[model samples]
Target: MTRVVFAPDSFKGTIAAADAARVLAEAWASVDPGVSPVLRPMADGGEGTVAAFAAAVPGARRMPITVDGPAGHPVDTAWLLLPASDDAPDGTAVIDMASTSGIELLDELRPWDADSRGFGQAIAAALDHGVSRLVLGIGSSASTDGGTGMLRALGARFLDARGAETAPGARGLGDIASADLSALRPAPEVRVLTDVTNPLTGARGAAAVFGPQKGLTDPSDQQQTDAALERLARLLALDPAVPGSGAAGGVGAALIAWGGTLLPGAAEVAHLIGLADAIAAADAVVTGEGAYDGQSGDGKVPSFVASLAAASGVDAVLVAGLIAPDADLAPFTASASLTEVAGSPASALADTHRWLHEAGRRLALAMRGSGPASGS
Candidate 1:
């Protein structure tokens, strides 16, 4: 009887992390009835981050706010606030960038001219409500103005060479030559949760990795994004070369400049959930996400699980919707093996449950060194 643990992030539109794990366990039980499976639903400080943190800290409260979504529509955004303890008078609050500015909210790849000003507005509101400690999840954002829009919403004025406040769009970013934060206020404590280590500028920056996804596929769009990033980075006095600075459309740059400490998103989640401790007791651990590849190495779900499994001397296996052909799984191979869910990526994406069952049966067969009987 193998002691297995299933810790996986959501498969995006297919299934929630918890449900996915449950399905995997069901499939595993079909092949090996005695196998024990532990479930740990996870996220990477983007979507569903608030729920994850709330699970870790029950003292946290969920507050709703109407903020601008990817389509510039008002969305019922939520953030987590930790209740004050005896030592701390005010509570700690967390702002998920995805809640206010994620690409998932967009219906189609429309050219968005607006900046991240909406995010700043949301944070400021959280502060006004007596949150002394603020945690910002800086990934899955839609803007690329180096967080200038967020700063503007937070009371920092961005001015053009003509000494006029820039407009609240992409065009406005190009004219920004300076920024004034004297009128702004901030919480005593602020931290940014980032999943990547790319800098705020240059070839390895936001424009390179995430720009295309944001509908900035053309040269003109890329140049515009680059220009906006340049202006914002200069205004913030950031090196523009710091790792993780480009995350969340350069929200990482602004937050860091605003005194926000950056931490690995998956690591933070793992620590909160005692992932290492859980892995230490398991014989086999299963981990995965929507897609697994080199990008997963940067504090993504599977990579983090693999790391924990390694520390515990347990074997980890990755099951994903699609495994990139060129993906270097060696890092996960140290303690885990990668496996595709179905016949092809498209098929798996179409039917997650079917693929999960296939994966679970494979895992069971691998463990027992035998296949299941027909219809048994």
Candidate 2:
């Protein structure tokens, strides 16, 4: 039997990684009954990180909680608890911004107003549960508050010049005077996860690189927030030049200040889920994301997966919701785009499951040498 491993990141807003993997596997099986499809959904410590862990680890448990959302409203969510192991006797808790203070929770973008308090609240809950280790995925945050809101939630106080707490989110960055972390919960052994590697300040900083996407359109607003974050870094005695410090709107730096280590999200998740071993044993590995663009080569799921496949002499195949014009597809044995298959971006997103099946069938056929050319 031909062994194929299906490992794909969540399709962002369209589909969860586990569901996508299941759909793809079923379609591939239908197309080629001789194929042994292994479903191994993946994540880069983003939106579906906890769900990915839950699916991969048999004894993983979900601990439910409600916390302040990005828009300052209560949002119900949960953190994942991986059962105790020798490395982590008390268990490891998985928390991420995507399910807590994530951008998707907002009705609309509130670059200056959306705070990361919810993310911090979730972390605090995990800590209270006595998890000895933390795997924090600091991605998809809605705020650019330099992690102030999160710190506040963790018992660190960001006070104004008048000795009062500053307003929430980026809107209050300019009002900071001093910080008091004495009452803050000391961080346990923690590993912060993210695909981003930008520094905390300057041209490639959080404010400069991701501000616009979060709706910080005005040049003046970006400048102010950037300055504020730089000041915060100085106040907390953290280095602003640290790579990955700019992740999740300065949450990376904040975690560093709280004594957490930053690690590559995709690589960490791969190790956690035993992706490398699976690829080594498979004839081919298929991986993808919601969008494949020039940025896909940078520590992303598809690129990382392809590299592993190459080292193991396993063919790597790519499928994506959309492949930008400039995306380099050199590492893939074959590639497919749901947009091209569905004939439009809207339709593809509207019905991702259907196109995913089609993509899987085409990929299986290509491997069998009975399908037309693979692009799209």
The candidate maximizing lDDT is: 2
Model 2 worst lDDT run, 10 consecutive residues: 367-376
- Candidate 1 Cα outliers beyond 4 Å, as residue runs: 1-4, 29-38, 55-60, 83-90, 110-112, 326-341, 368-376
Q: What lDDT does each candidate get?
A: 0.74, 0.91
Q: Native-vs-model 1 lDDT?
A: 0.74
Model 1 clash pairs? Answer: 117-149, 197-244
- Local accuracy of candidate 2 as per-residue lDDT tens digits, 1-376: 9899989999999999989888888888998788887777888878889887888877999999999999989999999999998999999999989999999999999988998999999999999999989999888889898888889999999899999989999988888889999999989999888999999989999999999989998988899899999998999899899999999999999999999999999999888888899899999998999999998999999999999999999999999999999998999998899998888999899999999889888987887799853546
Q: Residue 174 CA error for candidate 1 (Å)? A: 0.8
- Candidate 1: C-alpha RMSD after superposition: 3.8
